[model samples]
Target: MAVRSWVNAFAVIILSVGQASAESSSGSLASSVKRLTDKFMATGAEGTPPGIPAISVAIGRDGKLLYADGFGQASENRPATAGTIYMVGSITKQFAAAAILRLIEKGATLRHGSTLLKTTTPVSSLLDIANDWTLEGGPPITVAHLLSMTSNLPNFTRRPPHELDPWGAVPAKQLLGGMKEYRPSGYPGSFEYSNTSYFLLSEIMENVEVGGSSRDYHRILREELFTPLGLSDTGFGGDSWEANRLANPHYRRRPRFSQPDWLKGSGDVASSVIDIFKWNKALMEGQALSPQMRDLMLSDCARVDVWTYYGMGWFISHKDGTDRFFHSGTVSGYTSYNLIVRPSPAHWVSVSLLANSDGVEGVDSLADELAELALKS
Candidate 1:
């Protein structure tokens, strides 16, 4: 299967499993979750190859944190805790998307009658290379297309020598500067998942003047999203002091290199599982965005396949006729998953999982199992 299809299928497998078990009351919710967590940690025992250095899990229901804990070790000696930070990978896209929407909302109220961004706005207006990056006379790409992963931009990281060092820094300008050499794989509205789409969006955020002069996308995220939501433990993983508290990324039971500076808006954010749950609470409570903006962020914009739809930075799915918003991320040595089910018809719940090793056995399945237990509780 294609890589994108495999990702979608894996997600479906977990969500399907979770929903199937949601109605079955096997034991107390806490006990069930603990059992699942135990199963997850067992896979990372001493004998396991590339054992997880740390794993953190958090669950929320109806805007309240239900449980938050960590398993395994953060390092050789330090034990992991709920507050142990980890690179959340593509889950950072949601914060990036929120920053853009916040800018648009702010622009709408400007005294000079500013041109607020809409879904149809041409991406070229914000990113310089979009003007020339086309394939076979395809239509101009739009902001919505990027959000929906339908911009058709080439997946640069997947190019020759597929295993590029994730810790090395690559400037966004340098990345975009090289885009002229590649052509779009599909038309503007075609769904093709690409990290380049989000990296371009990050560049656009940096270029657009919002709340005065332009700032780094990471700053915009902190001011517009993190600060308001009180996500103190969430930010770009750059500070040495904060780094001391972070769970070490590992491969084959050894420490891996650090994250790249260029992963800023796409995946570089380090955050605790508890902070992620807090983010879910703020988002679902309408504290982070206006109702209309929230709807836009959650609304399905493109069909990813038969079972999934892509929104701004979220993957929209349905379980037993209930809407679910989720995204998973896998960088060099970390894997993260975040899921939020809004209230009404659905049993409102949020689950966030962060592990120090990418592709750790049964991590995703454990997340789903924990979600199921949380929802049923």
Candidate 2:
């Protein structure tokens, strides 16, 4: 209640000052900026410690950035500035989606019945698994399913009864072979969240691109999507501290699995709020892909049995009598959300919250709070 009151007061003051400035040419732009900064700082100071850590948010209308701000620290006691870099987590799925779309535009074969079991790759065992990978009376696993997280492949890393492994740096084939051992839960077109499916797509993409490493595939994204869109701050690098330019992960202080680098294509990408803003712009403006390819990436790919409206890589929400397209990411201690108002697809917003915190519950609470705040804002 206090925060809401304060925001209302601040907005009124800002509007008043702007009106006064029109009458008297004495107010400097710096003064207006200072006032805005102070307003944000006041809200953040009152909102922090559990409110949200270092949020870098970019709100846009029609592919143009209207608001961008970074609040809190990149880590405990460390300030997060405009330059901080944080892991975008499952937001990496968007990049993977775009990359696969690029392959499709280039005529890579990802049609029905594209088997991904590798003969020379690390998971040589999955070649056997591929033998039985039928449609199960429906469509086979296509590249489209992989991009949309609809393959419903059991996450080999997080199988129950046994602790999920954080050491995903194992060769891609090994990951698939391990996944083959898990029991099936649903069919190919079923919508389910699984990092393993994206990693599997990454393996197949590695083979699709000529003489390209997965890193190369990502670099292609950097050069094509990010660079052209002015998202230089977003990238995948080997250093952990690179994420400091973004919010640090928040988690309760508990023993948790530590991730390894081999998980690169799945969730190892580092990015900034501004970079994602540029990404959203590029995606919506059709800068990175042809119009048809862009539609395929955003189109509904599958249906979630759990949620009537949610499907594939995106979540569905209703506000003001409209449906919103969005996705959220969580890894270890960090949680983030990306949402774009759809149909028009004009307004977009993303919030990234990081706590050196733990436990899925706390992280989820933080993400939910941040998302609610974004919706209201």
Specify the highest-lDDT model's number: 1
- Give per-residue CA lDDT, model 2, range 8-105, as digits (tens): 35334544555322121434433433344344434433444344455544444455443444456667787654445666677777777677666556
For residues 113-154, could you state the per-residue lDDT of candidate 1 as single tens digits? 354566667776666667765435766777777778887777
The TM-score that candidate 2 achieves is 0.69
Residues forming the 10-long window of minimal summed lDDT in candidate 2: 117-126
Q: How well does each candidate superpose onto the true structure, as a TM-score?
A: 0.84, 0.69
lDDT of 2 at 200: 64
